[model samples]
Target: MNNELIEKGYRRYVGNKIDVYFNTNICQHSGNCVRGNHAIFNLSRKPWIVPDNATLEEVKRVIDTCPSGALQYQEK
Candidate 1:
């Protein structure tokens, strides 16, 4: 687990090759994540950020679009 991210209030979503982190308090509701990949960022899902649902490149691409810096990732 990413203790640094956790300390910053970012929740971790574990995956095989990469791990996603989300800080809801920092989110700007930009919708980029969901629009970029529904399978990975489905809001209706309980644990919405499923890093394993998409490729590392795809996840990184979408997260890069986050204007608020609320989304981040770390490769394993």
Candidate 2:
């Protein structure tokens, strides 16, 4: 687990090959995340972020688009 991200108020979403972190406090709701991959970041779903729902590259690519730095990830 990323202690720094957790300390910064980002919730962790663990996956088999990757981990996603989201800080709602810092999120600007740019829609980049949901738009990038609904299967991975669908708000209608419980525990919205499912890293394994998308490919690792896709996950990283989308996370990079977070303008607010609300999204972060670590490759397992």
Candidate 3:
């Protein structure tokens, strides 16, 4: 696997924020992250992901569902 991409996928959120960075390459496109939680994951957009759009708890839940480890988060 590419470490650079992995690092890029790992994001940090500030003060109880949700920070999600989905790596397209690593993603299986299972849609679990996008479909499981519409409030946070929206596949229709250009970026297709805005971690800050959802709460930290919600984002963490979705990220955990990612089978490919494509989504990652950190708290600051």
Candidate 4:
């Protein structure tokens, strides 16, 4: 988990290869994260962001579409 992101109100979702971070307040609700990869960003899931569900490249690719900068990833 990222101390800076958490301190900034971003929640952490732990994964095997990477960790996903999200700040709901910063999200624009653009649906880019979910649309990019449902397996990783399913809203129905207990944890909306599942980094291990997809490849690191895939996760990064989708996060790039987040105009709000709400979603972030860090390498393990």
Scored by TM-score, the top model is 2
Q: Against the correct fold, how does model 2 do in TM-score?
A: 0.97
Show model 3 residue runs off by greater than 4 Å: 1-16
Model 1: per-residue lDDT, tens digit, 1-76? 8899899999999989999999999999989999999999999998998999989999999999999989989999
lDDT by residue (26-74, candidate 4, tens digit) is 9999999999999999999897788899888999899999999999989
Model 3, position 62, has a per-residue lDDT of: 78
Candidate 2 per-residue C-alpha lDDT over 1-76 given as tens digits, one digit per residue, 9 for 90 to 100? 9999999999999999999999999999999999999989999998999999989999999999999999999988
| Per-residue lDDT value at 32 in model 4 | 93
Order of candidate numbers by lDDT, starting with the best: 2, 1, 4, 3
- Candidate 1 local Cα displacement, residue 32, angstroms: 0.4
Cα TM-score per model:
0.96, 0.97, 0.70, 0.95
Among residues 3 or more apart in sequence or in different chains, the pairs in candidate 4 whose N, CA or C atoms overlap within 3 Å are none
lDDT, candidate 2, at 2: 96
Q: Residue by residue across 5-49, what tens digits does model 3's lDDT show?
A: 456764332334544555666778888986778856776775566
Q: After superposition, how far is residue 57 of candidate 2 from its true place, in Å?
A: 0.4
After superposing all C-alphas onto the true structure, candidate 1 shows an RMSD in angstroms of 0.7
Off by over 4 Å in 1: none
lDDT of each: 0.94, 0.95, 0.67, 0.92
Better of 1 and 2 by TM-score: 2
> Which pairs of residues clash in candidate 2, taking residues 3 or more apart in a chain or in different chains?
none
Q: Which ten residues in a row have the lowest lDDT in candidate 3?
A: 10-19
Q: Give per-residue lDDT, candidate 3, residue 24.
A: 65
